[model samples]
Target: MNYMDMYKRWLNFDEDTKNELLNLDEKEIKERFYKELEFGTGGLRGIIGAGTNRMNVYTVRKVTQGLANYIKNKGIENASVAIAYDSRKFSDRFAKEAALVLNANGIKTYMYKELRPTPMLSFAVRYLKTTAGIVITASHNPKEYNGYKVYWSDGGQITEEHAEGILKEISKVDYDDILTMDFEKAVDLGLFNYIDDEVETAYINLVKGLTVNKDIVEKAKNDLKIIYTPLHGTGNKPVRRVLEEIGYKNVYIVKEQENPDPNFSTVKYPNPEEHEVFKRAIEMAKELEADLIIGTDPDCDRVGVVVKNKEGEYIVLTGNQTGALLTHYILENLKTTGRMPKNPVVIKTIVTTEMARRIAKSYEVEVIDVLTGFKYIGEKIKEFEEKQSKDFVFGFEESYGYLSGTFVRDKDGVIASMLICEMAAFYKLKGMTLYEGLISLYEKYGYFKEDLKSITLEGIEGSQRIKEIMDMLRNNPPKEIAEIKVREVKDYLKGINDLPKSNVIQLVLDDDSIITARPSGTEPKIKFYFAARGKSYKDTEERLEKIKMEFLRLTI
Candidate 1:
């Protein structure tokens, strides 16, 4: 059916959805009905409403039924899927709906008893040996957005191969063909079941085991004062449990933002990458004189840190800073203690800071760069497990996602929180703060600064405009950026370095600076990533500013 056909068809859906559609103006109607909510590589994500282009029961069911078909075709008898949800609007409803649809298609589902983090879903998939997994969340997007992410049995987000195959099946599914059954019936038929604490316990235990400086955690227990905020999402219980159990008693929660609130009432955007989201936490950090503050996003997959600088002002650290800090802590401790795994390797995305590569090389640990998603990192981990060529120690993306252990392939904000707290404690015992620890890393690994700028272009015309912008850059590769000569330009879409083909470009500058342009995998935006280094912070930042100014001038 075309847009009108789908619109008319959806008009007769549930009364609540129909009412939502009836209230929309002409433009809103077109925007919501312009096309089917795209089931891209990640899965469904969009504004919630009643339209072909919106997230609703009909669309969710259609996608679930398609997943059911793909799983059934895998020839695995009695294959099941693990399901989890975050604290998002309709997250529970979409999760239950997906479960029942899968049940109706003869595939069993093991769903979390309550809302959980995305990494928990990834862990559940592998722990339960399910055929696939699904998590209903939009990560750190604004409250109006919700999403569904699919994971293969590998405990990682689906890669391009699985995405392409599953999307083909999703496209073939029709509304009439999308099967769903009663929740009670599904449960009675042994198709719907709640996940037990077995998986949860195992997950928390794994996160706790990733702690490197165990003795330091105990020593700093009395000294380090930490404040945490869940940002009205799902990181509350596990993050606190990990910290408390690992030997920290001074952990404080930002009560105002502690609960699971879909509205994310306090923050305009629920993303931890943004400094604004740390406003409340910063206030609490100042009041309590906290050693550091940590905030995780809605799904609890990404974490941001705020620390008191030498000037005594709380500032949020960039994802790159946090990532590099964690990398150094992990490797330095391992090397000093002689516990470093043989042939240990660290992985980072192409757009991540070059400092990670440099730090890993300093430790004699191999560093490999993949395309821009953690799924690719997870893929490398899987490859290592099979080939036994190298041991995967850590992987991270510049967008505040990090993973240490192989228990969960996706980023675990809970683990990150625990490890970050441990790192802080380790530094405090050495009589330094996390910010000071960050500076120390800079000194050892050279001064580095990174920034990201995103241009959001929503709606139909905005989508077209994004394509034009990418086309402009691709067709006419800039010879220079921000007055610096472009030493080399790498276009990944043409398939570079044997990595998966993606619509991304990276410009390496003559002065050892780096810039990358890539559309967000989960949002309708184009992002530019800049990384710079110099003898001092001011020099690097000045060069960074010039590059940013010129890049924007060329692209925008």
Candidate 2:
């Protein structure tokens, strides 16, 4: 439908929506009504407001109705779906609306009684044996945005085939035909159920069981001083509970960011990957002389860390550094404790640091590289379980998302927080900081550093520009980058490699450097991932900078 037709539909909406539409300027109205909000490979995400292109009650119900229809068509014996939400604006309402739409379709729905992390929702789907799951979260997007995530029966986000099916169903759903029932009526009719303490306890127990060496946490729990900040989202309760339950006593919470604040008042963005997001936690860490500082994003699916270096200054560890540290720690500990599996395997994204592959290789474990998203990692876990081909040990991306156990199919920050602290504690017991441990890994594994650059191009013109850039790179491939020899080019779009098709291109340099470029699936941006190996830190940094500059020049 054109913007005018969509605007007429909005005019007939409730009074509040009508007022919101009437107050918007021409530019604002056009941005919100020009197109329907995108339901990409992940799910629907947009600024939360009134319009066809925004995340609102109408869009939420419309998507849910389509999901309901897809579920019914599958012909599951008992059609049920699990639902959870974060602390984003209208997340709870959206979760409820989705549940009501499912209930109105005579499908059973279970929703959290309170805000929960995205990984927990992934777990709840398997725990409850629901046919599918939905998590109302935008996942570190700006506060103005919200999203809907759809999961399949295996507890992973919907794959491409399922997404295509749902999208087809959504295209056929008219706004007027979307159905919903009153929350109370749905509850009384036994179609809607609220879940709380029971699921939380089960999830916590599974997280605790993932610990490789419980004795280290028990011994260092009291001496390890750690500061944590949830960034005013869903991590507040469950993260704290897991730490305390594991016998950590000196843990301190950043008071200002402990509660659920939809606005994320203190930080410009709720993303943990940004060092600025940990400003308050860093301050607290300095005051307490804390051993480590950790921060989780809004949905608690991604975590970032700050640890004291040999120079006595706290430094934020990049996602690659943390991933390497934890991977080495887990594998080494399992080997030492005689718990190492026969066919252990680690998974990483194509864009993640190649250091993970090196670390896994040192231990004789296989490393599998999947596409960008963590759901691909989860899908691998499911494949492992079904085939018994390999044992899933650790999986991580350079984007600060990590998963250790198979209990949750998504990247889990709550359990990751526990494991990261536990790794810190183990190293502290050895009279070395995490920084020192990282340096040792470099000495052993060779110095490997990575850099990621995201160029945001918004609006219609911006999107066109992004496409132009991708096209230029794909059509006129660079034979060499930064004067380095290009050994091979793996264009994912062409299915050159034995991987699923995606709009990604990877250039492998003869000197062992790699450059990957792909448009962001969930946002209006394109990301470039660069990796370099050098004899020293300075050499690696210099090479990374030169390559980054050259890539930028090409894009321009």
Candidate 3:
């Protein structure tokens, strides 16, 4: 249907929605009602307000009704789902809204008593043996946005096959036909339940068990001063509990951001990958002369780490650097401790640092590259278990996501935080810092660095422009970038490397630098990822800036 038809259909829903729609100008109306909110593999995400193209009570319920239909169509017995939410605006309401819709459809639902992390939702699905799971989170996006994530019975986000099925069901759902029941009534009918402390303990125990070396954390717990910030989101309780249970003595929470604040008042984006988000944590680290600083995004699926450099100044570590550190630590420690498993494997996205591959190779472990998404990594873990072909050791992506152990089939900041500090404690016991450990790795292997740049173009026109940029790059591929020769260009749209077809282009440079261009699946943005092998950090930094500058000039 056209925007006008969609607008009229939504006009009489509620007074507040009517007011929101009537107040908008033509341009605002077009932007707000251009199309229904996208429901792809990433699920629904948009600015929160009234409109078919945004996230609101209507859209949330409609999606749930579709999911309920999908579950019922599968002919499963005792159909149930696990539901959780983060601290985003209207998140709790959306969570309950979804549960009530499921309950009305004669399906069982379990929702968290309070806000929880996305990984916990993934875990809860398996822990509760639910048929599916849902999470209301935008995942470090600005406060204006919110999202819905769907997970299948395997405790992983819905893959393409399931997404297509749900999307089909959603296409058949009509807003007027949506159903919901009173929360109290649903509870009385035994169709609705709330999850609390019991599940949290089970998750924490599993996180603690993933530790590579427990003795190091015990020995260095007192001496290792660490500062952590949850950034006003759901990481506060579980992250802190895991650290404490693992015997870390000197861990400090940044007081300013210890509690949940939906607006994320302290930081602009609530994303841990950005250095600016860690301002307060760095200040506290400097004051305490802390050994390390760590922060998790709102949903606690991604994490960031900060450690002192040789100059005595704290700096944020890139996702690549942290992934490599964890890879080396896990493999080397397991080997030395005689705990290395046979046929162990590490997984990474196509755009993640090759340094992980090098480190994994040094230990004779296999490295598998998947498409750029944590769900793909999670899917691989499930595949490994099913085939009994390879042992999944670790998995990471460049966007501040890491995961170990199969307890949760997504990137888990709670466990990532635990293992990062443990790695820091390991280096501290050697009388060295993580920075020094990284430098040693560079010395043994070649010096490698990676950087990213993204240009966000919002609304309809912006999306068209992104497609144009991709087309230009693909039709007339870059022979060289910043004076370096491009050895080859691999267009993923043609289904390269036996992977699923995607709209991505990768340029392999003569200097061993790999530049990848892909549009963000969930947001109105196009991103560029760069990797370079240089003689030193300075060389890589300079060359990276030059390439980024020249490439943007060409693309923009």
Candidate 4:
């Protein structure tokens, strides 16, 4: 059926919903119903709107109902689910609505009484031994967006096979048949439980275990001046409490963004990737002469940092740079203390810089590349646990997400915040800055800079345009980008590199630079990733600028 037919079906809805659909334009309707909410490697994320395809009450109900059916089919007599939400506009309501649907289907449910981080939801699923979990957040997406992510019993997002099963069940549900029992009734019948302080204590204890160098934190406790901002989301309480428990004496929270505000009043785009989001925090840091500034996205999964360079200017570190620095710090510290794991492994996304791989190799640690999403990294962690062949050391992605101790199944900003502060304090003891530490790593591992460019294609035609761009690149792979000879191509969708095929096509240049292109599975955009290396920092910057200009010229 056409989008108009779908829109017409909504005429039976109450006047409020029916009138809302009738007021939408053709483009709006098409955008809303262009495709189903797909279970990507990262789970479901989309702009909230009125359609079966968009994130709405009906979509949420279908997803929850599907999850309930999937859990029941697994032969678990009393299947349970945990649900949490962030501070987005409709996140809390959506989460409760999902819980209601699950309760109606005879599934036990545990939901947070208030907003919480994505990682906390992952931890809750395991702590409660629930059959599954749901987090109502879009991570760092704009205010207009929201999402629903599903996690399995192990606390990691559902694997591809399980996701397919859930999708099948979702398809079988008729929108009108999704029933919701009263919240009071569900609770009275013992089908619902609100997570409380006891669960919070368990989570905090797990986070505390992530601190490897407590002695260093003890030494720098009174001296290290650190600034942190939760960006008006769920990280505020946990992050602050963890830092305090670790003995950090002078931690400054950004006052304007300290509270949970759904609007994210302090910035235009709440994403930490943009330097502008840190303008106020940097100003505060400068005045206090703080060692570092940290900000986490709404759901507190991805983290961003700003540090003083050698020239005394505050600079925001790219996700790759931050990950590389953190990786180097953790591995070297473990080795120095003679505590390095014998069978250590470092996990990263396929698009992340190979420089981290090189650093890990130098430390005699294995580097494993997985598909995009931290869930793939979590899957690898599970693989290691079952096989006992390798120990999971660290995991990260290019999009400002990292995991260090595996206490949580997802990327954790709270732990990342604690580790980043410790790293800064470690550098301070050497009379250096985090910026200087990063530079030293570049000098040791060969200078490298990475860049990511995301081109948004909105509405129905936008997706087709993104596909056209990807197809164009695959058919006519760049022979040379900025006069550098193309040495190899890696197609991830085909699951081949020089060895296998993948949807991603990476072009290796004669000068050892690399450019890769792939369509984002969770959003309507194509991302281009570029990495260039040089003998020194100055040389690296020069080459990076040249390659960036060439890439822009070609793509834009």
Compute each candidate's TM-score over C-alphas. Answer: 0.98, 0.98, 0.99, 0.97
> What local lDDT does model 1 show for residue 112?
98
Q: List, residue by residue over 286-319, the lDDT tens digit for candidate 4.
A: 9999999999999999999999998889999999
Candidate 1 lDDT score relative to the true structure: 0.89
What lDDT score belongs to each candidate, Candidate 1 first?
0.89, 0.92, 0.92, 0.86
lDDT (Cα, tens digit) per residue for candidate 2, span 326-440: 9999999999999999899999999998888888898999999999999899999999999998999999999999999998999999989999999999999999899999999
Please give the distance, in angstroms, between residue 138's alpha carbon in candidate 2 and its true position after superposition: 0.6
Once superposed on the true structure, which residue ranges of model 1 sit more than 4 Å away at CA?
A: none
- As for candidate 2, its clashing pairs are none
**Model 4 regions more than 4 Å off:** 497-502
Q: Rank the candidates by lDDT, best first.
A: 3, 2, 1, 4
- Higher-ranked by TM-score: 3 or 4: 3
What's the true lDDT of residue 298 in model 4? 95
Task: Provide the RMSD of all predictions against the true structure, rounded to 1 decimal.
Answer: 1.1, 1.0, 1.0, 1.7
* Model 1 TM-score on a 0 to 1 scale: 0.98
lDDT of 3: 0.92
The TM-score between candidate 4 and the true structure equals 0.97
In model 3, the runs with Cα more than 4 Å from the true position are none
